[model samples]
Target: MSAELDPRLLTRAREVVSSITGFRDDAIANEAMERVVRGELARGRSSADLLGEMLFPQSTLSGTLVRAALVGETYFFRQPEHFRYLSQVGVPAALRRGSLALRGWSAGCATGEEAYSLAAALQASVPHGFPVEVLGTDLHEASLETARRASYGTWSRRESAPRLFPLYLDGVDRQVTILPVVRRITSFAQSNLLAPLPERFGRFDFIFCRNVLTYFSLSAREAAIALLARALNPGGLLFLGAVEADRVPAGMVREGTPELQTFRLLGPGESASPTPVPRFVERAAPPAPLIRRPMATPVPVRAQVTPPPPPARLHLEALERIEGGDVDGASAVLESLVRQAPDYLPGLLELALLRERSGAREAAVPLMRALRMRAERLPPDQLVDGPEALPARFYQASADAYLNLGALE
Candidate 1:
């Protein structure tokens, strides 16, 4: 757009755009880059001058365009329904029959928001915690660094609804930080959804390759879909962004409202060949109950409390603390136990239940609901009623939260 525009810079812009998105329109690419730099710098004359120097002065922009393009906006709970379906339907169906270890991949996971979001959703659904894991991969190493830092602006907070707002801690600068509970279950790495997935990456129970496929050409899209399909463990579910769904296989079923298409991988001894879409079969007999009564509350330790009980006998003390309204102290013990012994499903359930009792109901609800759903999804050979049950309080509070949001349907 300038009389003295550097042809070299224009070429660099086109190359950057094409490499990042596989789009080859040189003129459109330069126009977009100019617009991005100009828009970001337009706040003041000084900022405008700074951007002009950064973009126009140099023949090659220093990773600036890629950073700008990938510093996308996202929030803690950006897509509520997708998560709900994950909790109550998708995950459970996947894990129903066995003591299956589940893995989830968030391809093109920009800045870690989506991966952390999946971690939160997974924990909510698999209370008393099943064997589950999450992996977040983005092509940009720098973007992965920002995600590793795990901080975001008020702009990111826009994705959370008021009902769930209290669940996140807002920083002094109005940035939001994901709670420690959500961070424990996920890890991030640099990955490109195209090309061979890294040797270390393996089949997963769920894959979320969202909002990215639209950028690829038809051939690239199909190859990526095939690659993703191969990456899924049979019976795994794949979730796509709303716009990217059509690029996935035509035989896959697309469900849920405002759908980001969700597909299920065929189990072993099965094939990916299209099957007549199955009807919603009524569930078999209900599984056994999780708990018979309110669990014992945890207690606090005091120097004066005398002869600290043996670790095994410490349960009563911890129980007493919860009974005496020291839910936070009780939670501390359960959390420590879960960390020391990740296989301790009971500890996870107790912590989840105590969280609900402590009025963190919105956070607790997903744990119980997700647990039930995942338990149901286990393969028939490995099936068992999950080791934990939700306290009535959790469901009641969740029901209220849903009603408040008019999400009761």
Candidate 2:
């Protein structure tokens, strides 16, 4: 299969992919082209015809090439912190301005997990009777079809909190279907991030383009960000994946802790703008307090006491148990460590991995869910007095676990 195609033909295919999808990775573009070539040859079609089809606008082959070049890795509540910020920060600000109507856009919303997740978060956080609308846009029509179906296997729900399942899904046999309430507020459409947004797709108060920008070329990423910026209302919040923190555009101001990867569009007078003024004239108010829950009763001061051994020690002990083939013991140690320090990212991750390896993936679900919840409340700079204490590193570790376990792509 590899011997038949000319080198120049493959190079032409690669160039066409970059020009169409704006994917900059040479290796990925090459791989996708090779696969397309092989598949076309297998079907007794000429490489020239395949390339011509792919170059055609919105061709099925073109969509296939783009989908191959990009990953649609997503799950319900994959990044809980962003939803937390939306609920605890973005929503209340809008409500306070006497606007009960809220609009949100989930750009690159793979199969609608993110769009449904956002709707669920709003339903759970906001008071009843508050109106909300969510639009999910992606480049692939097949993904949109699945999004419209709203049924998922258990793997898609791996990162979903147990409490959220009952609130948003109905399970029958192996399939979990999204409830009407969540589905009613959300819609999906096919859209390319590099292209201009549809005029009917109005500006939104919140735009979520998490984990999608890193796949594009630098110029393409800038164009996508600019398009997202144009879609945002004045002072609207734009949430990117933590990995995309470095790629934020010029007209936006980073908001929340640095780890959060949330940005706010600066108002017209607040900053220089190369783009036109936002469509919505209403500006966001000063940020409301992040901690919305009431504080517990204050306790009297007590004498200083010795602190327990650091989480690192327990983590090592757990590792020793795994080495000794005592998986139960290791699990017990990790469970205790996480209980002692609920925000101990490493402990939570190790425990979840252990459960997954032991053929008890369900047992790991709650732990992973808990870790995601705690991760939301933690500051990005927050560190534990133990191994792998860097919050960003911990997040990377968590992401790795999710990918390895098939919770993410």
Candidate 3:
């Protein structure tokens, strides 16, 4: 806390912020609030003086706080993979769906960088004569103005950022302008993600709403995601941040691998949502698991690749990745999780099976041994803690089969 910061003023600011942003953490939301308070105080505005003024939703004070709170640093092509996927996978699929034109959105576009980036990607990827449009939106008015200008300072250009396509014009002092071509296809607006985009905005082929949700409360995040999903056309894709993949959107099926964190709205003739992965739960054993590996010759032991549910978030994420076929990525997650919480039963079991599957049965032995040791100490009927709440024996049987160590008599 800054010694000069006033607690009463901070409290008032927090209330206004919570009412508006639904930000999950006060400290993060407080960042802009503290600055606003400091600025007001330096200008001879007392804490009472500021509080005395109307700070309602439409008040000047409230607007100032929101602009400050929403201002975030961004650069061109921040996450290139989304662009690559858009150009390659997304474009063709939408084309196949017979999209007359492609629509894209950069939700919570902090500055014009992402919006312009989307414009460039769509312009380059979409076929000629098709109308392509991108709408970049944020609550920060000044940032939107900067985006509308379509000019950027050097800060917007990070050396490591991938330029999958040309973004800006090559100029000197007056240089660094977004190509007139890109500017033509892109537009910026000051808009709130918490609210539904107007009907005029129309449904989109894909939407990129990354990282911004990290600032939102649980309910707010869900609302924002649902709104974004609704904005997508049937077969349209919604792209979220990598860390934001934990919550699968309602009625949307997971697309690509866990790495992609993309979801597709069910198109015509597509099966309805059966996103069975993220909602790890305790359920009766399915008639068949995901994969049943070869049994040990003598006793014909079987190892089920699908996880028994009721796992921690980390484990669920790994399982989701595995379900998406990112084996190495899942292994990395499981290894770290098991190492940190060595006694975590689901981690031990799932990671062991992965290690065994990857031809590292040598490494798998110790994990299997550790898993068996742990599960044996627990009563077979006692369910382990996880979304699925599978019994200890479920893990023990898996471990025993991998080790070819025959189940306990």
lDDT of 1 by residue, 104-125 (tens): 8888887887787777677667
Pairs clashing within candidate 3: 281-387, 281-388, 282-388, 309-388, 310-386, 310-387, 310-388, 311-386, 311-387
Off by over 4 Å in 3: 1-6, 27-31, 273-409
In model 2, the runs with Cα more than 4 Å from the true position are 27-29, 159-167, 271-409
TM-score ranking from best candidate downward: 3, 2, 1
Could you give me the TM-score of model 3 versus the true structure? 0.66
Q: Against the true structure, what is each candidate's TM-score?
A: 0.55, 0.65, 0.66
Overall lDDT per candidate, in order of appearance: 0.56, 0.70, 0.74
Better of 1 and 2 by lDDT: 2
Model 1, C-alpha of 79: deviation from truth (Å): 2.8
Clashes found in each candidate (C-alpha, N, C closer than 3 A): 26, 0, 9
Tell me the lDDT of candidate 3. Answer: 0.74
Q: RMSD in angstroms, all models?
A: 18.4, 14.3, 14.3
lDDT of 3 by residue, 1-409 (tens): 5566668787887777766776644313455677787888889888788786536777788778767665365788875667877887889889998889998999988878998998899889877768999999988788888889888887787644568887888677744889988898898777788899999888899899986765565667778889899899998999986434454688788865455678989876877645443222112233332466787665435855555433487887886666555676787788788877787897887786677545575787888799879987876546786534555655664554445422221
Candidate 1 residue spans exceeding 4 A from truth: 6-12, 24-29, 32-65, 68-71, 159-167, 247-258, 271-409
lDDT of 2 by residue, 1-409 (tens): 2466767556766666677766654324355567776786789887678767766756777666667655666778765657766877778777775765788899999899888888887777678877888999988778899999999986566422333423355577788888899899999998888887898988888899987765455567678888898998877889986444343577887766544567788877886334332223122443344466775865557956567667888887886665444666777789889888877777887787677655676887787777666665554334544442344324433533343334432
Question: Global lDDT for candidate 1?
Answer: 0.56
Best by TM-score: 3
Candidate 2, residue 329: CA error in Å?
Answer: 22
